[model samples]
Target: MNRISIIIPMLNEADHIDNLLTHLLENSSKENIADIIIVDGGSTDGSLDIVSKYKSISFFSSPKGRAKQMNLGAKYATGNILYFLHADSFPPKNFDTLIITEVKKGHEAGCFIMKFNSNHWWLKLAGQLTRLSWQACRGGDQSQFITTSLFNNIGRFNEDFTIYEDNDLIARLYDRKQFVVIQKWLTTSARCYYTNGVWKLQYYYWRIHLKKWMGADAKELNRYYKKYVC
Candidate 1:
């Protein structure tokens, strides 16, 4: 049987972790989910305690970057597939079945179409764009699923990226024509938009994309994120 290990790389997500876990446990079957691994990046909040309450979950800690945390989780996974999810993102019902069906149909890796949990017109427009297979629309919040074999073959996410890591992976996959965009919708938090202001956030995002296109290195991207994002 093809089994999936869901890896969620988290940091100070105590408020969202429990609800996400409950939803996953309720919607996914034991036969499909081989393991649920929560990789924490040393959250100072009560996130660790909340994760510990879920006896079925496996937990691990990493230094601080999301790429590092997810890589650590992947190292411990025993499933045939790895589903990298965000704590504030909710995949549609039967998501595991959807992914397995796609993989069985020969897709090496893919991500769900996604919407921001906001009613802003701009955000809605951005969400609609994700339904397209355009590489520019990809983001970490959409959640990624890859066969373990393909993941190993392609080499995992680039740990050097402190930001724009998802785009980097998607870019590589696009180059090899190994990426797909599932039609299912994933609802992801708009907390960043809300915190940073929608228009301003969108502008910075475009700037980052432009910078990457202009050959900005990972360190430069990280500096931009530290200065403007968080």
Candidate 2:
């Protein structure tokens, strides 16, 4: 049986981690999940305490950065497949089975299409676009799953990235034609878009993509994200 290890990297996400984990547990079969690893980046919001209370979760601390935290979690994962999920995102029911089925079909890595909790026109359009295999539509919030062997072969996510680490890994997977966009949809929080004005945030996001395409390094992209998006 192919079991999956779910790894979530979080920081100050007390608002959603508990509920998300509970949802995952409720939706997934215990037999399909080998482990749930919650990698905290020095959260001050009692997130670690909540994670510790969970029966089957393994919690650990890492330096504050999603890339570093996820990489650390992967190091300790024991399952044949690693599923990197966001604290605020929820995958569809039977997601583990879906992923295992894909792996069985020979896909080495992939992510589900993304949907935002909100029903705004633009958000809906964005969600619809994720159905395409185009790389521009992919994001960390969509949630990623990869065979452990392929993950090791790709050297995992680059810890140097403060952001866009998912895209970086996706790019390599695309380069090798080892990635797919599953037909299922994952609903992710639109909190960031809500916090920052929708149009304003969207524009800046496009700008960041442009900058990255223009050869901006991780630090440069991080700087832009902190200044405009965060």
Q: Give per-residue lDDT, candidate 1, residue 211.
A: 95
lDDT of each: 0.92, 0.93
Candidate 2 lDDT tens digits, 1-230:
79999999999999999999999999899999999999999899888888888978998889999999999999999999999999999999999999999999999899999899998999999999999999899899999999999999999999888889999999999999998889998999999998998898899989988999999999999998888777
* Candidate 1 wrongly placed segments (more than 4 Å): none
For residues 108-208, could you state the per-residue lDDT of candidate 1 as single tens digits?
Answer: 79999999888999999999999888888899999999888888888898999998887888788898999889998899999999999999999999999
Q: Provide the lowest-lDDT 10-residue window in model 2.
A: 47-56
Clashes of each: 0, 0
lDDT value for model 2: 0.93
Candidate 2, residue 134: CA error in Å?
Answer: 0.7
Q: How high is each candidate's TM-score?
A: 0.98, 0.98
